[model samples]
Target chain A: MSESAKRQSALGRMMLDEAFEARVRSEPARVAEELSLPLSFVLELAAISAERVRAFRASQRHKDAVRGGKPPTKLRW
Target chain B: MPRASVGIGLRDAYVEPLRDLRDRRALDVLEVMIDDAQFDRRRMDAWRSLGQRWPLVAHGVALGPGDAIGLDREYVRAVSADLAAVGARWYSDHLCFLRVAGERGPIDLGHFAPLALDDGDLAVLRDNAAALREQYAGTFLLENPADILGFAGQGDAHGRESGRRYTAALRACAAGALLDVTNLALQARNDGFSAGVFLDELDWDRVVEVHLAGGRRSGGLWIDSHDHPVDEEAWALLEHVARRADNLRAVIIERDDRLPTLEVLLDEVAHARRLLP
Candidate 1:
């Protein structure tokens, strides 16, 4: 992948990362300060990430509930 | 094609408010989020109903027009069909890529990724625009994405030197520029340039639409969140560019999250019209 493409991928990954989501959710003010953005903005980012996380988790739950415990092939994130 | 002098981004959250404003004609045009309601029959009916009162403009987020993959064939066709159904004559999306081929097949980036402002990227954009023009038979504009981090090749840390790059990209695409004033404000705030200085450098004639949205500061960056009212800095920048963007046909107020009431948004739209008028 090209350098720009890598950077783009990294950003998307960061958004989908559960750990990163937790950090943002737990310490929005610190994240805001570290990124030089307002707390509200940080909260918004957390909210978006949280929504995505919920959707992913819900999909996971749905898969686990069916399919005889076989791992699903396609992750929807 | 006819254009709206002032408009607002249509959101499901504002459905009732929009219904209230339907007869009043408070908005001259409505920018439909094509991706959200693409194949839903009920929503399509709603859009058709809205179309009766106001002209619609298609705004998408997942077309990935600037990516190496170019315009997704199915996505473009869906958008074009819907636009035609609604009698819209213009289509737009951010000049950024959101999906890429991954080892697992294709990965969807829920966020918009900034394209490098260079000859290669410009050529890709041009090709995508040409494809869109041929397929949709309508004016297509590319909106600049809010940059949280500066691109690799764009000069300086703040992407301050991107004025020519933006102009060049639009020229290459032969597409109208949908100038997102607040996105530029976020760019300036994060990258160390005055939004006014950046706006002054744009070739305003290329601008076909002006987007007014608000952002908030988080971490150490200003995000183009579109959740709050238009900020003072963005309004000032709009005032500077609104006079020179002679081709400007639409001024859209975009608020996606933490949405104010429809009346409040209509008031903002009124304020935008006053500024542009």
Candidate 2:
């Protein structure tokens, strides 16, 4: 995953975590605001943590590759 | 005496058919796949309306419960919110971890790469289960993910019977099992084990639900693609399990990528109904 893709992935994870934290902590309004999303968006994807982890990992790899003289690959998810 | 009375895997194409089923009750339930929030909310009202009358189970694909790290509470919370919206009876995910520790990063599809079992893997599974139980507060069904034959050159004192040990460890921690019949069939064909025997080895009592999908033999192995119709042999096993296990909750038919028509999906459901005792 490229650096930009990595950033997007982090943002996605951040968005998802926002949603998860919002639900788990019982703070729907906060989750909604952080996600910049509506009430329903906060609900469907809250507990799904793996996708973000994969994206995060991909991004970290992108950075390492750049430092070690390797080209970047785009992240699909 | 039978499989959750009746059930179906929630599919995009079948929404209209399910809405139609609301008329004559051709379906009893739909296991909603919470792959994305955007896709789910679009059908939220309709899904809610369907579930009010018919039962629904929230089946998640990205819990990463098997990851060897702290639980992803964020993802769990997201799915929970959606399930609550639809009033789902329970929720589920795969037994395999989707993320793995990479060189200065995590590797996707790392779980598929077979390796020697270490204490860390087992610990992750236990924590994953406890975390899932904590997040959902209901039955957490962990599914058997698709696997391929690879020695993966594990270190000594790690590999021998790694597959069985890893799966057994997860079963020990999981609240219930979501054994995919097609996965067993594919594994049996590709991995040189009898599918029937494999199913027999499972903790049948803990098997709350059954997943049925179609696969085709490909690239020296059978791939568990949910695109086509459920195969005959796998369907037979479903019937057998329905007869053997008294606590079977539901039988879900899953299809992804290439979706079949509504009539075809309903026919598969009808086939399952006929097989049920």
Candidate 3:
């Protein structure tokens, strides 16, 4: 990954699409002004949101496992 | 020199084998995952018998103390009762939130998630950790989970955030740390930093325990699967921690997937004994 790519938040990479990145890059000042937060805060919020989404998905998977939605267990090396 | 007690996670898959080991007094402590096993009726009786022989530590995955909404009181009370019954040395959980309110009720993420290395995350951990320490007896240690995916803006510039967050969390909560050596190696592998660099930034005085495990690299990121044997990188990190962390007392090998035979697990435990101070 490029240095800039590495700097992009994990949430921005995983959850946000290219269009969102393009918008942020194109009008960072306007976007930051509209959000009433720094551009860095916007990225931070996205990262936090990504973590929340991960927790929610993991919770659903656990619920499914509890309800016997998983396959039979077996050991695989 | 204070030496660290070497043990393994008493997973259900290895319970019978561990029982044999327990009878022989081959292990020091068995870190039991609190939510993975039951603690009533015959099971409780069985645990009481085992508790008489071997030391057990309660490790939690679903407690999610880092949740903004505060930890679940019911869960804390239940864990306390179970640990007391088993005579556990301490209780610990990852420094991340697992559950959040859903439409129905609380949803528990079975996996340990990562928290943002920031001030807001630090506040949540500090508050919840203090509350957990108050509600539960014995020691409460916090472990840093694997940061497989390097979060946004936490590249070279923000690499120091992790150590900063860990330092602040320990200082604010005044709790011990369960430093998972393998997780640190995994993070360092994926995030382009040496594990030692991250270790150097932590307040080693707060670390009370260490965890070593095996992991695999997929898509250039190392995942802490705990299925394979302990690798060299993890062992090197464990050695580094042993040399620096003066307060370290316990070292555990966590193997949940593809568990090998009892002999093989014991070999890993022996390896830990050789590396620890």
Better of 2 and 3 by TM-score: 3
Candidate lDDT (C-alpha), each:
0.69, 0.60, 0.66
User: Candidate 1's error at B176, in angstroms?
Assistant: 0.2
TM-score list, all predictions: 0.77, 0.70, 0.78
**Candidate 2's residue-wise lDDT over B1-277, tens digit each?**
6446556777666677767654546767788776444444676776787777688887875566656644567767777777777788878877655554333465443223222234555666777777766667777787766554322222222222433553576565766777787876665565465655555456667778889988764444556656578888888888887887778888888876467776677788788889888
Cα displacement (angstroms), candidate 2, residue B29, comes to 0.9
lDDT of 3 at B246: 89
Model 1, span B132-163: residue lDDT tens = 87768888888888766454323243354677
Task: Please give, for residues A1-77, the per-residue lDDT of candidate 2 as tens digits.
Answer: 32222322333343224444346337655666754555544443343244433333443343234221223432333
Maximum-lDDT candidate: 1
RMSD per candidate (Å) reads 9.5, 13.9, 7.1
Candidate 3's residue-wise lDDT over B1-277, tens digit each?
A: 6687888887555666656763454678778777654433445555566676677787876687667657888878777788787788888878765554333444444445566645666677777777776767588888888764465334443456677677777776677899988887777766776666566679988999999888775544567767689899888888888998888888998876677887788888888888876
After the best TM-score superposition of candidate 2, give how far the Cα of residue A43 lies from its true spot, in angstroms. 44
Each candidate's B-chain TM-score, in sequence, is 0.92, 0.86, 0.91
Worst 10 residues of 2 chain B by lDDT: B151-160
